[model samples]
Target: SRPWRRRLWDAVQAAVLDPTNGLPKELRAQIAGVAMAVMRECAAEQPDLEFIAEMNDHFAAALWR
Candidate 1:
């Protein structure tokens, strides 16, 4: 799954708190967009997910980034 949650959360935190973590400006702009896309895709694929639990899962998954 390309470590979607990790990548997503890392991207978000980077954009929020670290503006110059070695990433380029343009690529940084796409961070939030990509994160949202990944979260949406994951949610869609797992229709039976418990919303809060799954969301927590994603946050936990992000920690492994």
Candidate 2:
């Protein structure tokens, strides 16, 4: 499970790495949708506050930019 989570993170990272793909309007919306769902689920678990904060910040920065 951890490994798959890591893989998913990796894929997300890769997907956003390229300015071309990352800058596309449609792709940005899709990424925001997926990240929002993930962040909500992650926060629902009442995880370590620091980790949750970090994850939220990460996703927010990506989606907002």
Using lDDT as the measure, which candidate wins? 2
Q: lDDT scores for all predictions?
A: 0.56, 0.57
Candidate 1 lDDT over 1-65, as tens digits, reads 52553554555645644755676766655655555654565557453335534665765786699
The lDDT, on a scale of 0 to 1, for candidate 1 is 0.56
lDDT of 2: 0.57
TM-score of each: 0.35, 0.36
lDDT of 2 by residue, 1-65 (tens): 23333445456655765567737777766765665555454546453446645765776687788
Q: Weakest 10 consecutive residues, lDDT, candidate 1?
A: 45-54
Error of 1 at 34 (Å): 1.6
Off by over 4 Å in 2: 1-22, 46-65
Report lDDT (Cα) of residue 12, candidate 1.
69
